[model samples]
Target chain A: MKAVRTIAELREQIGEMKAASAKATIGLVPTMGYLHQGHASLIRAAKVKTDIVVVSIFVNPIQFGPGEDFETYPRDEARDLAAAEAAGADLVFLPSVDTMYPKPTKTKIAVSEVTSGLCGASRPGHFDGVTTVVGKLFHIVQPDYAFFGMKDAQQVAVIEQMVYDLNFNVTIVPCPIIREEDGLALSSRNVYLSPEERTQALVLSRSLRETKEAVKTGQIRTAGEAKELLTQIIGESPLAVIDYVEIANFPELSPLAAETAILEQEESVLMALAVKFGKTRLIDNCLIQPKGE
Target chain B: MKAVRTIAELREQIGEMKAASAKATIGLVPTMGYLHQGHASLIRAAKVKTDIVVVSIFVNPIQFGPGEDFETYPRDEARDLAAAEAAGADLVFLPSVDTMYPKPTKTKIAVSEVTSGLCGASRPGHFDGVTTVVGKLFHIVQPDYAFFGMKDAQQVAVIEQMVYDLNFNVTIVPCPIIREEDGLALSSRNVYLSPEERTQALVLSRSLRETKEAVKTGQIRTAGEAKELLTQIIGESPLAVIDYVEIANFPELSPLAAETAILEQEESVLMALAVKFGKTRLIDNCLIQPKGE
Candidate 1:
């Protein structure tokens, strides 16, 4: 398990690997270092789908909001590499800030509708950071496929849109979320919890699952009811401050008003939620569908 | 020269060419069809510097203004090929509007400071179109080097800034402007002119010569004086409606003001002018330097 520290080093290794085997498809799993099962799931998915899997570990500064975890984002390089190796990744790239952006880069990819609505509304310039850094990673790795965790569903959507729009010629594969035994979404920020905050954070994932169940069993009338129930669930946790609970349709990401949208689009009312536990903002979601369809 | 009509075909040809010789270096000259000495000059420059020169002939629709010549841009494949082969181009790409765009492309590249001034101020969304289409062309060709005519001087500067800011690895080579015996800048739009309009269009080039003479003879004191003389020169032509005549710092594209910008920077100032003759707008420029420097 060798750790590559620079963009040049990663590019050289990938180029050599490409020369050795013409059919050696590369799969990239981008991460912000502190590894958990959610990231582990993404690595494993990439490993299974491609000939070589490269995991990038960078605590991206641009994506962090001013009041957010820019400074305190957890990083454990050794642990991350060990976990990546355990999950069957062939290479681990840990680039310095200079390695990622030596100078100010002006090029950015933006998705108009999908980006402006969800997390983008809360974290200004956050998706811009995600898009820019992912673009740099995509260029450096030159991967055949890039795997992303659906925990940040908006991020996955943005990257997919950017890839399609930019003609990058790389496949964007979205992997599923890996949760705790309590149905709490696994995140590196979970460690920031003071046991009580950890417990409060579970409300986000739990309410989402409850909303899914409500929709599944015909307990909810419209998307509005599910939204109300999810709000109430988080309100029960005193320490949990909910930011937003949105049910948006697939790809278009428009707010789900009823079971159907205009244009007879294949609508997906993703029950997405965001809640703050202490200083850290955690996010989670579950898909809800109409009873018959 | 082998013409590739689609990106798929071009990519396949590139694969075979790369396999045959790893030492082969690809150069690209992107142009709209009706090839002239200007296009040929770029192609010839590409042939000298790289092993494989691919000339793309697609009149980009995005770059044309609403009432501009998008509908009337010239095309003649046989004539273009004869010019391309004579100039030593190895591959000629003549993709259709569908092949180049396929659909409405969402991705775009923008250079803030450089593009906002110059022709950008007049042609709304023009440089955006150039940046977007050239980006796609670079992706498709994946050339080692790309060539452009300095006749579209602002376009060269915009692309240079974009390539630098975006970390695109291709070397940008700016070729000298190709002109007719009478000093009019060669352009595909020249074909649209009546003989009288064609002769009147010579004012665009002649104004630059006047500015050059004024600066050389120490008669011009400031940018205003130079532009005023140009306005007078174009006013002499009955059909020529003067658009703009100004000198500016090369990459910055800032007007050469006596109070603000130092005379030292005037060495890099580009004297660019645009004129309209009964509908067709023509642009040209001359690079200025300080006297005895």
Candidate 2:
């Protein structure tokens, strides 16, 4: 992969690739530079549908809170380059923080209702960070489609709603979460977990899976029951602490107080949660469909 | 001119136009449907540079306050259509308010510092409305360049700042304000003025001209003097009630205080004022460059 450091260089590279390509479509898979299987899946998905794939490997500073590993966010340029090449990416952009966010960046793209809920509830400006950085990436890359992992379901939904509302000319494609053989979702933050906390992290994916299974078997009737089942399972895992449990409309992300009303539109319920396994906060989600017609 | 009412149809037309002629750039001029010479200038400029020119006539509701002219804003389709054809516009889009802003448009694209001042000060959420509506137009039309008149200088600056900060993929073209032969700027709201107020409204432009003269002969040194001159001019005109007099940064629209030190980076100054002559609010501006070394 040709690693580009400046936005102009990256845009020039993308422009050249677009000019030379048959499809003329540009895809972006933005990440913070630790290329794990989750990142790889997004890149692979992007390569399938678009002619030119640009992978941004910037560790966005605004996304990280003051004490939240902004400095320690991993950067392995050689490995990331190799991975992007293997994933069939046409360009790799590694912009300097200065280039992406100049000192005078006072403007922000905010999606109001959906952002104030979910992890946004816990992380304060987390979704704002996600949106603002993603917006910059979208503008710089000018991608026809952007690939994101469904593991951050709320993030994906927030991004989709933002695109729909803000009129960004990009499609958001949410790929299923990439997982380990034992079913733990793959994340770069997984590196921060201790061996014991890593084991305890299984509760997140396992609880989501069990709730999905219960809903399929009619053991879960309402959103409350489905949430309760997951709650009980997660409570049993001594090492995990719950942050929020939500089953919400796909677009609005408003938690369903009653059983989800009929899905009139192309809407599904998001069964999502964030849990603290030791000091690392891990999020997981599953989509809930209505009973078979 | 081909008239389109639906956003999907407008986008489809823009898409086909782009596909057929990639180098045939598009220039968009967005307006509320009250075609005047000021709007004609923007359409003419767009006609000069691009293969296709689109004029979106949407009277955005979000920008208006209660008791404001949201419902009463003038709409003359016959006049507008003739003017657009005369100006060589390829298409005229008169989208319905509901079509432009669907229900629950919670996403607002805002330029923070620039918006918080100026018309933003007197009219809350005005720039947000401007940014959001223009952003929708930018997405739906996907114009290579968009035009705005210098009469709405703060709005043009806010838009330029938004395009820069949000990384919108379009060049903002700030066209010169088209004026009547009387030195009064042409505006759609000019129709609301009574004959007597219409004559007195000339004070707005004349004050700006006099301010230029004052600064030339060293009568005005600071922004305060320029503001004071504008206020005194309106005060002398019995029919005119001053709304605001602003001396600000040319691009950022940040308020300039006389006591503040002049930094080298802050060179251009914008002097704008709004005065109500009867039911109509007349506005005008003059840009001043700093003294030479």
Candidate 3:
């Protein structure tokens, strides 16, 4: 395994690899370091699907807001390198901020509609930063396939649209959301939660699981009712403060009103939420594939 | 040269080309296809610099305004194919409008600053359209080098910024302006000019040349003075009506006051203009690199 710290070195290494094996299929797993089981899953999946797996770890500052956790974002390169290699990442690209952004960037890739709701509305300019870095990474790696965890469902949707819009050659493989046995979604930010706050965060996944069951059993008829139930569940935890509880049509993310009852013929819908447990903000979601579609 | 129309066919052909020669450097010359001497110059340049040249003939409708000439824009695949071949192109991509835009496109690639003045100000969303189509073409062709005629100086500037911002793995080569014996810049729209209007169109390039001379000789120190001189020269033609006459610092296109006289230490400036001869609009520009220290 190789660790490349510069774009030039990364490209050269990939180019040399291509020269060595012209038919090799390269896969990329892009992450912002502090590797957890979720990133390992993506890397392991890449290993199966591609001859070469490249994992990029860069804590992108552009994706964070003024008061966000960019300053306090975790970093442990030696640990990350070992974890990535163990998970079968053939090369680890660990680029510095200066290399990623050499100058004040003036070009922005904007996706509308899908980007307007969810985290897009809460943290302004967040998706753009994600798409920009992902786009840059895609070009640099020129991967045959790129793996993205479904934990960031909206991020996957935005990237799908960007790839379709820009006609990128790589295929985006969306992996299933990896969660703890206790139902908490795996995230680097999960480390930010204190012990008490960590237990309270369980409300997020519990609500989602309950809602998925209700949705399947037809107990929840409308998107509005689902939102109310989610809000109620998360609100009960004294440490939890709700940011948003949204139910939108799957993929398109079209908003559903309180009065917009779930249809008997509806196949799938998405339920997502964000809550602040102390200063640590966590997000989670689940897709409801209604029964008897 | 071979011509491929469908995106699938083009991609397949390019894939085969790569399979044959893994290290070949492809060059692209994107054009709207009334293939004038200007486009031929770009194609010729590509032939010299690249192992394979792909000239794309796409009359992008998105770049034209609602009442603009998109519907009536000139196209001739046979003539263009012949012209491109004559200029030593290896392949010609002649995608229909339907193929290029199969559905309503929601994504756009936008470049700022350099796209703010001159034609960008006169025609809203025009540069976005250019960048979008060119971006699509770049992805389809995956060229190592792309050529653009400097006749559309701001277009070149906008594309340069977009390529840089997006970190496209392509180098932009801005070719020199190709002109006629009477100094009229070669453009596909030149066909729209009536003989009398064509004669009057000389004022566009004439003023640009005169301004270049004035700036070089230090006779026009300030951007304002240069604009006045250009306006006066074009206004003298009874058939000419000015659209915009802008003098801005090169590349950046920053605003410079009319009273800010020329300085001995000045290195570069871009003087550009758009004028209407009857209903036909024509544009021309010159980049002045001042002599002496």
TM-score of each: 0.90, 0.94, 0.96
Q: Which segments of candidate 2 are over 4 A away from where they belong?
A: A258-267, B259-266
> What would the per-residue lDDT of candidate 1 be over residues A244-281, giving only the tens digit for each residue?
88888766577877554222335556778888887878
Clash numbers, per candidate: 0, 0, 6
What docking grade does candidate 1 earn? acceptable
lDDT of 3 by residue, B31-55 (tens): 9898988899999999999988999
Pairwise lDDT winner, candidates 1 and 2: 2
User: Residue B282 of candidate 1: its Cα lDDT?
Assistant: 87
lDDT of 2 by residue, A1-293 (tens): 67888888887888677667635898899898889988988899998998888899988877777667788776788898998899888888988888887775777777888987888888777777788889888878888999999988888888998888877889999899999988899888889899998888888889988888877777666777878888999998898899988888776788887564323224688889999887778888888765422
User: Model 3 Cα displacement at A74 (Å)?
Assistant: 1.7
Give per-residue lDDT, candidate 1, residue B259: 42
Q: Which candidate is the best by TM-score?
A: 3
Better of 1 and 2 by TM-score: 2
Q: How far off is residue B257 in model 1, in Å?
A: 2.7
lDDT of model 2 at position A27: 89
Candidate 2: tens digits of C-alpha lDDT, residues B212-253: 778767776677777888889878889998889988877867
Order the candidates by lDDT, highest first. 3, 2, 1
For every prediction, compared with the true complex, DockQ reads: 0.41, 0.68, 0.72
Off by over 4 Å in 3: A259-267, A290-293, B259-267
